[model samples]
Target: MNFHLKITWYPKKRKSTISRRMVTFSYQVKVNGCNILVCREAFFSVHGLQNNQGRLKNLQKYLREGRSTSPKDRRGKKGNPSRKISQEAVQTVHNFINNIPKYASHYSRSQKPNKVYFDHDMSISSLYQEHYLKYCEQKNAPQVKVSKCRDIFNQDFNIGFKLPRSDTYHVCDEFQIQIKNDQLTNSEDIIRRLKIERDLLHAKASAGQNMITQLSKLAKENPEEYLTISFDLQQTFPTPRLTSEPAFYKRKLWTYNFGIHDCVSKKGHVIVWSEDEAKCGSDEIGSCLIKFLEIQKSQANILHIISDNYRGQGQNWATVALERSLVRTGKFKAIEHWFPQVGHTRPPCGRDFGRIEKHVKNRNPTVYTTHDWVTVIKELCKNNPITVVKMKQADFIDLTPLEKNIAKKDKHDDGSQFRFSEATAFRFDEGMPSHLKVKYQYTEYEEFRTVNITKKGRAHQKNNPFQLSWKYLKPIPICDKKLKDVMSLMPYIPDVLKGYFNSLSESKEQSDENETDVIDIGYIV
Candidate 1:
């Protein structure tokens, strides 16, 4: 005997109590000569199954299987998928991700299963579109969608797109975890101290920002008397920056941008240079500051500066010496430098840097050299054009020798030795040209721990105090490895920019000190 069966479905309009329009399906089944419209409750009652929408949906799915005879129900059946991702494809993804340049968190490198961060320019969609597709093509592996790639990254990898900031500070996190797990014997004391440290950091940061705001108002009120500014070094801009896939992998020459923003005038000065010209050291920063002060000398007699507590750039001996020299030269009667607590610095220079970053990101023209960056920065803001000081090899002066002549003592006059990194304020006054007044807390300005900056051996001359002279800096040569990388990217760059790439000459002897440092930039616009 031969049997015939058929199944059909159509939309059944239904409305819920919530007054929302909903559409469900009604199914009909025919076996041999009998035909019946499947009723939700009646079907379940007849089959001795639980009456529910899930069962009803499963029934509908089963009937719609398009079988010549009644099809078997697969709702409760579980088994491995018919096809799975190939091992080669998974390995390809892992290899591609592992090869992408990743950096360890500067502060949390010691954390277990170390959390690595990718560049801001990198994203799953971008990787899939710009690089992964071609990578798959080369390996003859099946290309995956962005969703698949994201899933693989989320489930298999231990990485983060953004690095953790002060909110999730590694030290605080470690202490909290230790206390919770009862891992430390003196956990209570440690917790209390940690809280105090965190509170002090926040308080100092708040005080510093308040001081800037006050200085801004004062500068506006008395433009000729007070000049308020914040300066910061932006992330190194890699040259030969192109949208092409090959350029993404190639290492390009570094271009440095030192941004100094005036609080009162709302003007930005970007000191730009290439790695071949000078390194982003303390001396280079001092040179930029000197140039900026020289330009603004006619505007103000006193200066107020705010910056992050970065030892290498702003809070170093060279910077202190440079400020002392400024006072000694009578360029400024008094200079007050404020440093926001580490990890809490949000300087005004960041705003200008953000605009520059946005302009570079949205620019239609390619930025292949430091000159291109200068051109972009010059016209960054139409209302007030940015002052782009394209720093030359001749402009930078070596302040290291002068800094050595300045005293770096262990104790102040009060017999209290403060950590250099812990100091939040530095004041240089013309009255005491050789003395540096230091404050550990930003909230206090009544008194300072005066540290005599005069070298012990050198006598402080009343008339001819510490004099600053220009010691010409030699040209800093690029490393051979970096030059080779730049050469590899030459083919991808435009012909007009080819000369810049060709001119990158490697040094005869590459010193480890000359190698570019991996700066962990945070919260900079």
Candidate 2:
């Protein structure tokens, strides 16, 4: 007699990266006239044979020494409650109800914000509220309100509740895992480069920590001469409540904030400007840093600045230019700039930003204009005297000339190479004012990279010729050209800000949209 056979592999044989070494296979064969199943494990289990006996020793070890997965043991519950729910009532409710609300621990709630977690078991009140008693309709069913149910659940049973902890995760794609097998053309060289980069990161992190230690010593020894500061940029929307849709879809602009925070004083200097005023670029950041230095230059003879290693803003040519310009002014005896290990920075400026955000989120006011945001922020930080300094387009300097001048007079680059990966910190000595050198690292002076400000060509963004004054507390009063249009948007604006839009400014009308030509942006009009 002839036989027909079929087989199926668990993961389908064609897929790459086998997750499991053993593939489960299911097969069936027809011999003669009867069909036969060839799953030995299933057959043995169905035939009343034990398969987990091989792991019995491990199970015994786990029961003896392994940590228990019980909430009572973790939360230090003393003893059983004075009151109790009958096991029969619990079993009866279990048949009809899907879920019963239980008690959650305070510690767990703090850890997982926005998540609901419960520690104690379901109360009699919850069951009553859930109509569990009605479903069971038994004579002995407990009668209780929500509050009494809480007491009953607390006092009654040893059955405790726990929130489900999501521990395991699955990646939908195999490519997500970097196996390093096929990519390893030469593992030795790749490992060497990895180690070099790791060392650089370690050195940078150590330098960032050492700055704190150095600040303590400097503050105690030279209190009047030493200053430590860090600065970063933040963006707040014109509106207090943000829509869930993509920002581009909302048809709105952003407000940029340049925050300079003193590490020792814990004070912040915030510069707020409209999107039309300026962008968060090297030029804007450089200007803000320069202004901050000008404010502190009179008091401190030595300045230490710590920032993150971002290309265009904090750790690039613009920053180098600012450092050189400051040192040349002779306001400080020594100036040092250090960048923390990328992705590991907890800058005080960032903390200042967080505080501002917390205040904004708590208030959640109606913000219809850029000035509205500035007003809220300034008012909130009024005690700290965080004034909203408006930056104009004219205030932004063209550093290209300075860059050229530095390289022209001194045969060396404008201390640009001081940013090399080997050095975590860079400094300019008061004695050797002309040159910039990486601190604590000795390298050939000639090997320093040159600073080229315009190395990366101009941005694609067109310059906004119209300079509207953002210093006002209200939304740039609907321009005359768009007065009717903005009035149409009034209905959509939040109720509190509706009054601001009722009276539009009678200012000069803007040119028709079709009159202005935009280079890259395509317009239907």
Tens-digit per-residue lDDT, 265-341, candidate 1: 88888898887777777888888888887676655788899887787689999889778877887878999998865
What TM-score, over all chains together, does every model reach? 0.63, 0.49
Give the C-alpha lDDT of model 2: 0.53
Q: Which TM-score value belongs to model 1? A: 0.63
Question: What shift in Å separates residue 509 of candidate 2 from its native position after superposition?
Answer: 10
Return the clash pairs for model 2, or none. Answer: 83-155, 83-156, 84-156, 103-119, 125-149
Which ranges in model 1 have alpha carbons more than 4 Å from their true place? 1-193, 457-474, 506-525
TM-score of 2: 0.49
RMSD of 1: 13.4
Candidate 1 at residue 328, lDDT?
84
Top model by lDDT, which number? 1
